[model samples]
Target: MNRSACLIFNPVAGQGDSEQDLAMIRAILEPEIDLDIQLTTEEISAEELAHEAVRRGVDTIIASGGDGTLSAVAAAVVSTDISLGIISRGTANAFATALGIPDTIDAACQVILQGVTRTVDAADCNGHRMVLLVGIGFEAEAVERADREAKNRFGVLAYILAGLQELRNLHSFDVEIETEDKIIKTSAVAVTVANAAPPSSVLAQGPGGIIVDDGLLDLTIVASLTRAGAIAAAFHLFQTASAGNGAERNDIGYLRAKQFKITTEPPQKIVVDGEILGTTPVEIRCIPAGLKIFVPSREEEEAVEKLEGLPNLTIEEKPSPENSPD
Candidate 1:
């Protein structure tokens, strides 16, 4: 049951004690596996470290940071046999939360040690990697407003405050969404293309729960809404994500596609996996079963099974000695 892994730890990810976090991770994971710790720095990025691990043929690459760090590390491990693990040290920790991975260092490491993994879909957006949802328009504005200083001071409240301020100045723009079988042109305020998202990501919950292993992306578009309407729409989508209900409102549109071409009037800011990457007029395509991740098995994740009407975990084969690299 021995394995070798590279722990790509981001020291400045969340407002937590990184030294303690690092020590805890080493204490828990080192005893079980041959853990090689790599701290992310300004000079050395998480992505670069992950690539090094992959190049060295490490059996697994575990990311210990927020969703951004996880996404960056995952980008390198995608399509490879290496299993990815998350330690959930980000403010949102959205990807880890979505997969029901424990946020605590001990629990998260235990999940990795347990070795129950699944291959989930990832996406390529304009050549960048996407492990979580891509948000445009309203969501982008909010994410852009919540800078590192604001997040360090306010934690998750930073995002909420930014969103509340943005809701008052809502504007609609032209959108032409094209897929393999259909092209729909509409006007909207915000659009979300999600591969995996938690219930908190209300706008991405088009079909209630996002099925991560389905080899498709969920798209949710919201038309221009007044402040009140936006709040109501968010509540509606929350209900949809929580109760497995429909959008129920006409203003909200939902779709599923393997590839999507989106063109907007004025280029809107794009936030991919919590980082504001670029403006839109972007093309995104799903990479099915591209990344394997460590997660709790169905029997082990029972506590979260009925919590939010979330879909079932896409269980894949556990890693074996045969699959481990030299």
Candidate 2:
């Protein structure tokens, strides 16, 4: 009951995620909003559809796909007044989950009707933009190796297989990370520059401990480890993620910064949200409250309560980590 809205959906997002229930979506939304539902085909992607909605002055644009689709729509709406909404149809609804939106389509529709709004942060790397996360090294490699066919068949388990395969071939990168104050050098297996928690599907990863609204990117650096070290480090990340709420200094290498730069001795792959977006020496900056999103009052309350305890920490380390990878 706030304003008119548009839903840009990809029918092929999940297993048998079809248009059969689209009429139901329309019916549910019509009473509360002036609804326009766009079912995406191969030629016109949901991102393109979102841009079209923006051009028409639609106040709220709902992305109804997975993390990739959500990232695309967020990119399209960046710096625009149009708000973003989510309808989770992907295998791992990371963006939606980070926003704390319920997973079911009908449940999501009801939340949208409730019409509560929250401002969330975002990050930009080179040309790629994402809300939940951007990463390099092992994690990016897992994304590159993640199988689409297998994901459709096995759902979230597909990423598990891909991650295991990448772990075997995992190579550490000589990373020189500099902010505005200090320069720290480490050979890391993986580094995540995050805004929200990681994508919804990657529930078991280190970023499950990240909070979206805190105005800082949670810089998670997995220091280079031998086979035993890797397993130990992986356990630590899992344990800390599982424990959740409040963080210990060394348990995770956590940093909060407004802007940051990261460089590697050699180039590395980058995954923004769940989409691959080139390599490093990427410059990252946090846009505090950059997006307005629709959520139910319960979700809004939950997000508020969740972020209340984190300390407001920002870093500007010296020898700024900004440049294209050499």
Candidate 1, residues 217-260: lDDT per residue as tens digits?
99999884587888888888998778887687888999999989
lDDT of 2 by residue, 49-109 (tens): 8788888988889888777887788878877878777778788777777778887889888
Which parts of model 1 have CA positions greater than 4 angstroms off?
Answer: 303-326
Tell me the TM-score of each prediction against the true structure: 0.91, 0.85
Candidate 2: global Cα-lDDT? Answer: 0.75
Alpha-carbon lDDT, every model: 0.89, 0.75
Q: Listing every candidate in turn, what is its Cα RMSD in Å to the true structure after a full C-alpha superposition?
A: 7.9, 12.9
Please list the residue runs of candidate 2 whose C-alpha ends up more than 4 Å from where it truly belongs after superposition: 198-208, 245-252, 299-326
Q: Model 1, 325: alpha-carbon shift in Å?
A: 48
